[model samples]
Target: MVRQERAIRTRRAVVEAAAAVFAERGYTAATIAEILERAGVTKGALYFHFDSKEALARGVINAQISDDYWVPRELKLQEWVDIGMTLAHRIPKEVILLAGIRLSADIQGRSLFGSAWPAWTQLVTDKLVEAKARGEVLPHVTPRETAECFLGAWIGTQFMSEVVSDWTDLNDRISVLYNHVLPAIATPAALIRLDTAPDRGARVVEEVERQQRESPVPTEA
Candidate 1:
């Protein structure tokens, strides 16, 4: 059990180090030596988890999205908004996510590891589908189209935020984005109830963590 836990930690460290390098330097420019040094792990350890740089890059790309189990909200749109807000709040602090987004956007890198956009679109579509079913979204809103368009805008917003403020104001920019976009998609009642505060992401993340902590752990009978 201990060995498994240590191996998990080591693999995570290697992935994080690689992500940091990829985020700072484009995928092609980054080197295994640098990742090794950054991770402070032996070459063997890295190779054990990932045989090549491509594999490491793929690992980071796959690891970027938050599969966090959030407590479901009464309003599905709120949960959908939380998805964006939490990402905006967390991305700046997470090099893995930053690297993944950068790598996914890199035109040159696209052939090697495809963009994460489709996966993200699907994720958003699923949530929006739920929201629509609940009548939280407008009748005219097509969940897939809305999700794709919103993702395109969100990607652009991320790029602009990173360039302008190195991501310091990402949450604020995302809040602004939600404010503009949600009004059109969400029902008037839903739109008025939704929270688009810049700090909303942080709060949402905290709520998830708090829920996790408070949730009862199952014990063997």
Candidate 2:
């Protein structure tokens, strides 16, 4: 158990180090030596987890989608909003996420390792499908189509935010995105109940943490 936990930690550290380097330098320019130095892990250890820089980039991309800080809500639309807002909040703070964004956008890297956009689109599609099933969305709204359009808008927003404000205004941009887009696809009731505030991400994270703390731990019978 201890060995497994240690391996997990090591792998996480390697991925984080790679992310930092990739975020600072484009995937083509990032070096394994820099990542190794940042991680303070031996070559063998890094190779054990990630055989190459491409693999490390893939790991960072995979880590971009997680439900660790997500909490269920009465409104599925609200949950979808939370996912975007929380990611907006986290992107500036997390190296892995930032790296994922950079790698996904890199023209050369896209050909080599593919992009994270497909996975993100799928996630949104699944959520929107659930929301449609619950009658939170308009009947004519197709989840996959909506997801693709939203993902395109999201990538454009990120790029604009990066260029215009160096990503300091990303949360606000995402909030505006939700405000404008949700009204078109969501039911009136769901739209009214959804929170797309710029600070909604921070609040949702706090709520998730509180729920986690208040929940009872399960024990084996």
Candidate 3:
């Protein structure tokens, strides 16, 4: 059990190191040596988990969407809003998320490793579908199409923020985006009830963290 736990930690270290390097240098320029230095792990250890840089990049992309820290809302559309807002909050501070965003944007290395857009689109679509079933959205709203469009807007907004303010203003931009996008799809009742506050992501994250801090871990058997 100890050995398995160590392996898991080692793998996470390697993935996080690779994410940092990729976020800073892009995939083509990033090297295993830098990753090893960052991870404080051996070459053999990295190779054991990922045979090549492509594999490492794939691992980073895969790790982008995980058991994310979340706080659920009663409203499904609010839940959807929470998803975007949380991502907007984390992307600026989390190297893994930033690495995924950067890797997906780079056309040079994009074909070597596919982007996370499809997965994100699916996540958004699923939420929208739920919201629609709950009558939160307009009857004419299509979940998948709306998800795709929302993702496109999100990516564009992220890029613009990155260029303009190094993502210092991403939360506000994302909030603005939700406000504009929601009106078209959300029902009048839902729109009126939703919270698109720029600070929501931070609040949600804090609540989740507080829960984690208060939760008890299992005792050794």
Candidate 4:
């Protein structure tokens, strides 16, 4: 049991190190030697744990999105918005990596679409669909279309946020969605007060960060 636990720790360290390296240098420029040095592990260990760099990159993204869990199937639209804002707060680095990947030529959408994107879209679509069904959203609103627009804007905003290091006003973005964007699709009454929701959501988001920090998960190893 102790040996297994140590192996898990080492693998987590590798993913984190690789993620940091990739975020700073990008995928094409990042090398296995850099990842090894960052991880402070022997080359053999990294090779044993991951067959290649591509697998390691995928692992990094999986850690970011699902944390290896199945996606949530049910939520109100407001809840979905809360989750996005909170995730950005907790794992800004990982979110940046995703943005970097999308912009990078080395990685393709198909590599992650079945595993990650569908799960994300499903979560967004489910909430939008539920909100429309519940009359929280206007009947004319197309859940799929709204989901795409919301997700595109959210991802784009995260990327732009990265380019500007000093600006950390995700709440402002949420406010725009609530007051302007979402209202255009749904009723104003359906809009959530993010200032209030973040208070509760912050706790949940912190718990997620704590879990990822304290209990390291096994990766390729």
Model 1 has how many clashing residue pairs?
A: 0
User: Alpha-carbon error at 63 in model 1, in Å?
Assistant: 1.1
**Candidate 2: tens digits of C-alpha lDDT, residues 96-157:** 88899889888878877788899988888999999999999999999999999999999899
Q: Which digits, one per residue and each the tens of the lDDT, describe model 3 over residues 22-129?
A: 999989889999999999999888898999898999899999987566556778999889989989999988999999998988888878888888899999899999
Q: Which scores higher on TM-score, 1 or 4?
A: 1
Question: Global lDDT for candidate 4?
Answer: 0.63
Q: Measured by C-alpha RMSD in angstroms, how accurate is candidate 4?
A: 5.1
Winner of 3 and 4 under lDDT: 3
Ranking by lDDT: 3, 2, 1, 4
Q: What C-alpha lDDT, on a 0 to 100 scale, does residue 130 get in candidate 2? A: 93
Residue 87, candidate 2: Cα error in Å is: 0.6
Lowest summed-lDDT stretch of 10 residues in model 4? Answer: 66-75
Off by over 4 Å in 2: 211-221
TM per candidate: 0.91, 0.93, 0.96, 0.72
Candidate 4 TM-score versus the reference = 0.72
Give the better candidate number (1 or 3) by TM-score: 3
Candidate-wise lDDT, in order: 0.89, 0.89, 0.91, 0.63
Could you tell me the lDDT of residue 87 within candidate 1? 91
Report, for all candidates in order, the number of backbone clashes.
Answer: 0, 0, 0, 0
Between candidates 2 and 3, which one is better according to lDDT?
3
Assess the local accuracy of residue 45 in candidate 1 as a C-alpha lDDT between 0 and 100.
Answer: 92
Q: TM-score of model 1 relative to the true fold?
A: 0.91
Tens digit per residue, CA lDDT, model 4, 178-206: 44566677665665433324343465566
